[model samples]
Target: MELITYWISILPELGNGVINTLIMTFLAVSMSAVLAVILAMGRMYGPRIISTLCKWYIEFFRGTPLLAQLFIIYYGLPSWGLNFSSFTSAVLAFGLNSGAYVAEYLRGAVQSIDKGQMTAGLAMGMTKFTAIRKIILPQALRFVIPPWSNDVIYTLKYTSIAFLVGAQELMSKAKIIASFNFRFIDTFVFVAIIYLILVLLLTLFFNWLERKLKIPGFEIKN
Candidate 1:
């Protein structure tokens, strides 16, 4: 096929870009997930000061445009004598941005559990922290999975923003290839297909996870 031939001809260049994109996306998402969990727990169980701080952080990051945030980390930080590599900047921005959203997702998940569950755990001699860890989080995590999947997909797409900051991810590579080949449409279309395939695979994997972890009487509907 013409498309196959075209892709084959440019596979080497595109492959390099794919690696960069994966690196950025995986680092960003993994860091964000960890940070998000901490923020969520703070908001849910920490003292008023910690909760307030978490709220402020969530509002600040979620309020700003991703592009603006990227610019601040990539461009604004250097004025303070703190410098980061392009890849580092991209990872930081993406992680912080995704964390804001993830925090909110987790907050909702934490709140959706019945207050009775916490009460029961307390009656059973579990401390608040232990109750949350042993009782609330497991159920909440199950409820959060669908939203978490959306966040994962969003993070994957947002990796494209790395190009603006000069991180050589997939979109950046596509731009370079386009410039050299004068084939913007072709290059972008090829990149798009690659992204589509990756997303599809992620979706399938999540679906399998959902099935594997399904609660006896509770099934997540697509």
Candidate 2:
């Protein structure tokens, strides 16, 4: 069919877009996870000043729109003598925005653990920070996995927003094809299906990971 041939012709460009989208998602997810850990630890265990600063950072990111954040990173930062490529701007925006939400999830997981665990660690002659690092973090990390999976999926889909910053992500390529061929419906539907498939795959993977890491008879305290 002519439609089939048209799709075939465009697939290569869209495939490259998928590759960029995946790379952006991976980098954003990784950066966010690392930032989340630092923010969570600071908010939960740091001194008064550090805790306050961490709290405000999380709040600021969580309160603002992600689109606005992306705009600031890509368009507004040039005024401050800082410049980043569109891809880098997208990654940084997504990472910082997602970090705020991920940090909150991690903090909640940490809080769900019994306070007595920390007391026990301290009684064993461990410093507060050491006890947290050695004993508490492992449990919290495992507990945080379910929520973290959702965050990863979110980050994956949110990569489409990168197109607004002129990053050549999946959606951007679809738009280009549509513009050239005037086949908006087919191009957009194809992109949507691609996104759906990616989300479903991630869901299945996370479910398997959760089952594998589950602790026998372990219940997070309410």
TM-score of each: 0.95, 0.96
Query: Which residue pairs of candidate 2 clash?
Result: none
Residues 1-222 of candidate 1 have per-residue lDDT tens digits of: 986787788889889888888888889989988999899999878899999999999999999998899999989999999899989999999999999899899889788777999999999999998998999988888888888888888888988988898988888888988899898898788888999998998899999988889989765444
Candidate 1: RMSD to truth:
1.5
Largest lDDT belongs to which candidate?
Answer: 2
Where is model 2 poorest over a 10-residue stretch in terms of lDDT? 213-222
**Candidate 2 error regions (>4 Å):** 1-4, 219-222
Question: For model 2, what is the C-alpha lDDT against the true structure?
Answer: 0.92
Per-residue lDDT for 1-222 in model 2, tens only?
877787788889999999999999999999999999999999998899999999999999999999999999999999999999999999999999999999999999999888999999999999999999998999999899988999999989989989998998999999988999899998887788889999999999999988888888874544
Error of 1 at 158 (Å): 0.7
Computed on alpha carbons, the lDDT of every model, listed in order, comes to 0.88, 0.92
- lDDT agreement of model 1 with the native: 0.88
Output the TM-score of candidate 1.
0.95
Candidate 1 at 101: error in angstroms? Answer: 0.6
